[model samples]
Target: MSNRNKKIIIYICCAFIVAIIFYLFPHFYSTTMREAFIYFPEDDQIEFIDASTNIKLIDTKDENEYYLEWKTASETDKKAYLRQDIGFIFENGVLISTQSEWREKTKKLKNKVTLHGEDSGRYEAITFHFAEVHYPDDIIKSKQIMTEDKHYVIDTPLSPLVDFKKAKSQSEQRGKELLDSIIDQQLTYTVEGLIEQFKINKESYHIFPLTEIAQFQTEPLPSMSQEETNAVIGRMWEGLYRYYLLGTNTFTEETYDPIGNTMPFVFLSKDDTHLLVLYETADKKGQQLLQLIPKSEDNENLSKNEQ
Candidate 1:
């Protein structure tokens, strides 16, 4: 194909991909899981899976400042998988946030956030799951979580300062409680939003939800509608990092400490299927997926303890 025809083929391919992506809507699944599959787009092929769903995006707005591909489960063919993610960019590096989750055991999973660059040549990206509480509505809930001396218990005692350590600990506990309460309150009150985004996509454009999606026994994945596709095209992640790499750039290797100071990430699933997760960190360059480790068993799968 000539260069002009080749460009036309690319556009036609993108259009067809968008058409397929919007094919599945309003499907629910019995299990909650997502897997990220890496594909070689430049090669015009996908590996490890047959019959994949693809999406091509273009922002008529913003004059095309952002463009990229997201390789994930295809909601249409049900061959794509979904994973809870938390990602953001930071000045020193990216901070991929996470929370600790328990599975009769304990381990970490990197949420959706990613990061790059550090003040020093050294940094580590840590992701894991943590135990947490959920309220029916985002607008109203009692009790909160406060971490004290690296421990967790709901509803810390509130009082004036007694001793500095005790007072500080107590204050931290109160803060957790207050924050949790606020989180619950926002889901129901003036803070609530999202259901509408689903409606228009469902009735008009025919797109589907990426997370919390349900289909037969196939696979579940994220999706997009005309509006969603529109919303995402121009709006690339507004990361706080000083630099970000395009696909062709080189990256440095680094790791972050996954201990006390990291914040917990929480995902509020609207229909018990779709989740809105918030992570407090980012992933370093070249780290695309955070391995999900159950917190018990053993630290057997951890990256051989770098160091």
Candidate 2:
């Protein structure tokens, strides 16, 4: 071949290589990013009680006795709070019996209030204790005046845990449907009504779209430290602002422009005993998850006071 023909072939080869690299780069980057947050089985000493639900059995080998450890996937290496020794009898990986102690010990008190929106109407303000537990100290401090109660409990039957692995693998539409069904099953009140009310009273309710919350969770703010950023990410998996809506007395400064002028909303059971939150996953892949939380009696006096 002549000199010009040889040069043209070399140029074409270089362009093809460039195109291949560009196509593969995003996949490589995304995989690396996801791996950094994943907690491998070898990283921790505890063995999983149920990999489906990400439930770990800590310290004891007895199948009958369980010290259930619960935490976000990102914080698996860190010490997990909400460790409960629920005396459960397991036979071949199935729960055979629930001890009376488990029933009596599961109750905890939750902060409850009534939100009166000027245009949005009235709503029962149920505090998300999960948010308080996982959020950074500064975020907690800013919202402390909203309530004095500080207790967290997970009623497994009412508030079913999510399988993070399953959620990430599912299609976006299926994920949304799964979330909707979970919420609908547990809720005694109407979520549609709450959403309709929020539409008319947007300013009063302070309701925001899921997109804004996703941005807040996935992107680190300029003011945030590494620790704070990690905590926020952890909170996303635990399903606070991501899946559920928290009630506040005053309107927040940030504004959201929801698609079709409609805002996403959560469902609360009667007397705010249960809450169902629908939110996008932390990966921002348009897939969503439902987080169900149930209020338990903290103490005899608190339960009686509310009654």
Q: Which run of 10 residues does model 2 get worst, by summed lDDT? A: 141-150
lDDT by candidate, in order shown: 0.24, 0.27
- lDDT of model 2, residue 295: 28
Per-residue lDDT over 218-273 for candidate 2, one digit per residue giving the tens place of the 0 to 100 score = 45423444334333334333343312222111124222321111123433233322
Residue-level lDDT of model 1, residues 136-248, one tens digit each, is 44221111111111111222234321211122465655655554465335433311233342222222222321111213113322343332222121111111111122111
My TM-score estimates for the predictions, one after another, are 0.19, 0.20
**Model 2: CA > 4 A from native:** 1-68, 72-164, 167-189, 195-215, 220-307
* Clashing pairs counted in every model: 53, 6
| C-alpha root-mean-square deviation, candidate 1 | 22.8
